[model samples]
Target: MTKPDPIPARLAALKTTPTPELKKQWRELFETEPPSFNRRYLESRLAYRIQELAYGGLKPETVKRLEALGEQLDGGNITLRRIRADRDRPIVGTRLIREWQGVQHVVTVTAGGFEWQGRPYQSLSAVARQITGTRWNGWTFFGLKNHRRSA
Candidate 1:
């Protein structure tokens, strides 16, 4: 019998595939085509080609879907609290004192003005709003600087 044309040569190329994933791909695609003498090998070759084609030409939609799916599979949410600090003594007026972490600074509040570590500020409320926003906890009036005691 006459030997068939050299399709087997094409199929033989699948043997050089370096990975198991490529081997599996060959198995799946080879199953679809008609049986040549080297059908098993050709299947692998076809699978490799398919894999190479797929890897080389990924669509944006596929990339986005994969990213979304990955996020869905392994994802979580987080809540963040604004960093704050306490003062050894309160400044005058409706001042809100706070300290930012990772910095050597103290903020003080007063009715007429605010101070950050003694730097004068326009208004205590403005300073408070800057450090802690509109609503922050833990501030109250206790006593004025005892001027009479100095006398």
Candidate 2:
């Protein structure tokens, strides 16, 4: 029986035969860059296999890993910096304004045409200026509170 062709030879032969010239070119491009080469090829191959298992639509564990990968690629952590920058920008006539009538004398100040929590605001700067009586941190002030529901 013949032995199976090795992966590198198979990959390198994709464009043409596995001749010395092709092998040399493939080695030059990929041998010294094993991480990049393996990541480019192996990640997709494995991710696709995982996706196929997930396509069964019932494997919760597999689905979770795929979702995690999606988050990493989307740079969810880095996006936080972008969100802070966005919240600091001034809004121009885009958000709805509401005045609070309680004893606190604070304005509810909805819709500053920006989003601090998941919900959109009228304007982050305007909301900050109006709520705290001083230009305060909009992201901190407007963060959503997850209150536990009473049983």
The lDDT values for all models are 0.47, 0.46
Per-residue lDDT of candidate 2, residues 1-151 (tens digit):
9977455454443444333444344455445432323233443443343444434444799888988986765557767655654564434433333333442322333333554334454545556555555554454444422321211
RMSD of each: 24.9, 18.0
Q: Candidate 1: where are CA atoms >4 Å away?
A: 1-12, 16-55, 76-151
Considering every candidate listed, which one attains the maximal lDDT? 1
Query: How does residue 49 of candidate 1 score in lDDT?
Result: 63
Residue pairs clashing in model 1 are: 26-44, 30-43, 95-109, 114-121
Residue-level lDDT of model 1, residues 48-103, one tens digit each, is 56665545556789999998976664453222111111133343644443454543
TM-scores of all predicted structures: 0.20, 0.20
